[model samples]
Target chain A: MSEKGLLIVLSGPSGVGKGTVRQKMVESKLFEFQYSVSMTTRKPRPGEVDGEDYYFTTKDKFKEAIANGKMLEHAQYVDNFYGTPLTPVKKMLAEGHDVLLEIEVNGAMKVREKMPDGVFIFLTPPDLMELKDRITKRGTDAAAVIEKRMAQAKVEIMMMENYDYAVVNDKVENAVNRIKDIVSSEHVRVPRVIDNYRKMIKEN
Target chain B: MSEKGLLIVLSGPSGVGKGTVRQKMVESKLFEFQYSVSMTTRKPRPGEVDGEDYYFTTKDKFKEAIANGKMLEHAQYVDNFYGTPLTPVKKMLAEGHDVLLEIEVNGAMKVREKMPDGVFIFLTPPDLMELKDRITKRGTDAAAVIEKRMAQAKVEIMMMENYDYAVVNDKVENAVNRIKDIVSSEHVRVPRVIDNYRKMIKEN
Candidate 1:
């Protein structure tokens, strides 16, 4: 295939259901893409496959991989190293296979540095998405509680500025559908498919 | 709603089903947007009410409006003048209402010069969309036939480079669906929605 694979970087603030939305997208066969398997120091949870769910690794090996710059984006959560192997992801993309990377905000920022052209999507929190409704309900909520949420949403909005598209995680299925449309729309974008069309012209 | 509306401009080469796709999108109620009424000098057909379909006007009046620069984009087709009124479309967009404008490539280019921020979608021909398939069938058709089609497709692709998205008109329903997705995805784009979000933070 002459078409190059797009690196879809999906990230958002914590508790925005990034993992759940990603899982639903894969389950629904929303878009055809290979997952950039994350290598984690934590032991596999029940029913989690070795290479499918995650590449289970030891702390020392993970540290070595990080030291060697093999990870595309790596981070520690609860004393466990979680990262995406850079080479495998690059290999899949080169073969015209889109790679879906679900990383935390910090890790996504790192990926942005390495892959500036990637399609970066930010998932917005449901509460933050309903700011208009929340404004209408100002009389119901405590002033302190409302102020705290508004402050948190402000920070998330700042993080979202780094992304190209933002999807509200009000519903997982709806979010996946939006992403499916985005991927389809991206495929036909003149900038992405122009080269492939150009190749066809040249060959003939 | 505090959100500003988008100007969705759909155009393509002749015989690319641009009208069919636009009609389908409206029938499906795919996205909430006002239909931009086009002013024309052509006599209304049976059951085609003025203002609903077209604002029927005399040739002299149409020419005077065009001379005054009131038309956003106008074209003369078969001795009849057809053009869009600039004031209404701008009024709708200013009131936070999206407007869909299906125009010819030349008129679209004119609109682009005036409203560069509009979402411009180009409809590609089905034959051109399957350039790969046709490549395999290169031997089946006469060389001249193939060359002619390729030349036409090349012109269309060149026109497409001016658009933001290219949807192949293989199926009218599929094209409408893709457009629906694009509109939904476009709504949450950070650049479009960030100001509304910024307002929320400042208000509290």
Candidate 2:
């Protein structure tokens, strides 16, 4: 059987170390993982590459893509349209390269609707206090914003049941290894391997 | 949430190197895994421990256990009764130790009927030719018996579709590592971890 690449959605609440885990996974080179670059109307920050970080686009272009069904899943956050572009992800999967989409819970849920077979992984902090500490230490957001994010985090944690796997990001290295294991094991899933076996049996 | 250990069933046709892989897994000391010892009416061979190899039992006792619904699955092979004792498996699982059962396809299917939640894995040879070579090299069975076994292997390979995972035993080390990964990843399954996340969310 011709193996198809997996569409893996890595999502978690804010400050759950999803980014750190994903960064380590990429650095490890354990698997041929291609990030599904998201299209966003938000302007790029300093040191952010246009295509590498995100496909920064005009609001009108993003809306046009949405209207044409080019966006797999899109959401508006702080008046900015951010969504996964369908074309690249589809191309990557068709070429047998596993695609990783690191998005928010809402976007992940939306992706689930379009691609139900995708592996949805939710990365969680060891504890809520740990999550709070991580966010607080970042110092990027105001106290009120962090509080709002924490509230949102609780709601997102409740959505963990919707994922295929829930990995606790207790340590970045361990979390990355777990994700690697998950991906490796998923390749041998019965449905995916049955056709190959059938062909082999026929040949034999 | 309190974690319950997994019931993992490993099965394969003859000459698939299941024993070697299991040995490697045990030697790694990665997780607490206990074997679900089977009871057999056949006398133990040289250097075989009664409990460790198989729980040697009288034919009468084996029949009594089968009648009492104690055998999870049983079969008559070479005029001897071989079966898995259900009580010990349950006890190990209750004690939070992952249980491994290495049995034939029929026994694995029977176990599936009894414990539908168990993770069933089918180990396979790289190809039928490799399987034939391995079986031939063993120098135990006659040519006629080997032919019969090859036919049985075909049937068993077809049954691989019913398993949760199909791992090719091309290399013992790789197969062991893949099974290790599967066990590690299965723990983080969404349904298994959702309760823990719910409790944490509520507590916070």
Candidate 3:
């Protein structure tokens, strides 16, 4: 049987270390996963390459793609549209490359609706105090904005049960290892193997 | 939070190298799980240690234990009653020691029903031919008995999907590692942490 790609959607609160965990996963190179380059109307930061960090786009172009159904899922955040494109993901999957998307809770839900077979993993902070500390330590947002984000975080934390797996970001190594274990363990699930066996038996 | 003991139920078809897997797990000493000694009515083989290999008991005493609810779960096999006792398991759990019980499918089911929180792991032979080769290589069972076991294995194989986790026994090291990862990963499940947090918050 041919190897099939996995569509993994990771969602979490503001500072639960989702990006760090994803970075570790990419460095490990244990699986064939391609990170989805999101299409966003927001301008790229310094040193961030176009089509690598994101597909930097205009508001009209983003809206046009959304209208044409070229985007798998899109959302407006801070006056900018961010979305995952379908064609690239499909092409990667067709070439047997697992795809990973680091998105927010709302975008993850939309992706789940679009691709029912996709896997979802939600990262959570070890504790509320630690979560508050992490958010404050970032020092990018104002106090009011941080409070608003924390309030939103509580709502996001409640949605942990909705994801197929939840990893608490207590430590970077442990969390990354957990994600790696999940990817490996999921590959050997019985249904997938049985399906492969059936196809093999048919070929025989 | 204090470390809690795990009740692990391990079941697999014959020739799946479950015994080897358990031996390696014990060797690793990663988790504090001990092999549970089952009470059996069968006469002990020469050089077998009572209370080490099994708790050799008379048929009447075995039946008495079942009637008195001392036996955790029991089944008749070839006119011998083999069962797990509840007292020692309870004591072990109370003292924070994880216990692993290697039993047949029916026994595993019974334990799962009794202890709804128990972890059930199903080990599988990589394929039918490999299973047959391993069984024959054992050279203990008669041809008729071997055929009977293979037939019985088919029934057990069908029930694998009921298990919480499934590991294929292609390589002993891989199987043991899978079980180890599963045990470690399960302990970090977010709901359990959330429950502990909720309890502390309530107490405060």
Using DockQ as the measure, name the better of candidate 1 and candidate 2: 2
Model 2, span A168-201: residue lDDT tens: 8998988988999999999998987798899999
The parts of candidate 3 lying over 4 Å away from their true place are A1-3, A68-70, A90-96, A197-204, B2-4, B90-97, B190-192, B197-204
The superposed Cα distance between candidate 1 and the true structure at residue A78, in angstroms, equals 5.8
Q: Residue B77: error of model 2 in Å?
A: 0.5
Q: How many backbone clashes are present in model 2?
A: 0
Give the CA lDDT, 0 to 100, for residue B183 in model 3.
73
After best superposition, candidate 3 residue A48: deviation in angstroms?
2.4
Over the stretch B16-129, how does candidate 1's per-residue lDDT look in tens digits? 778888899899987899989999999999999999999999999999998998999999999899999999999999898999999888899899999887888988765554
List clash counts for every candidate, in order. Answer: 0, 0, 0
Best by lDDT: 2
| Model 3 chain B weakest lDDT span, ten residues long | B195-204
Tell me the tens digit of each residue's lDDT in model 1 across A108-179: 999999998789999976555465354436566676766665666578768778888988878899899989
How well is each residue in B1-204 modelled by candidate 2, as lDDT tens digits? 577779999999988987887888789887678988889999999999999999999999999999999999999988999999999999988787899998889999999999987889999999999999999999998999999999999999999988999998988888888999999999899987788788888888
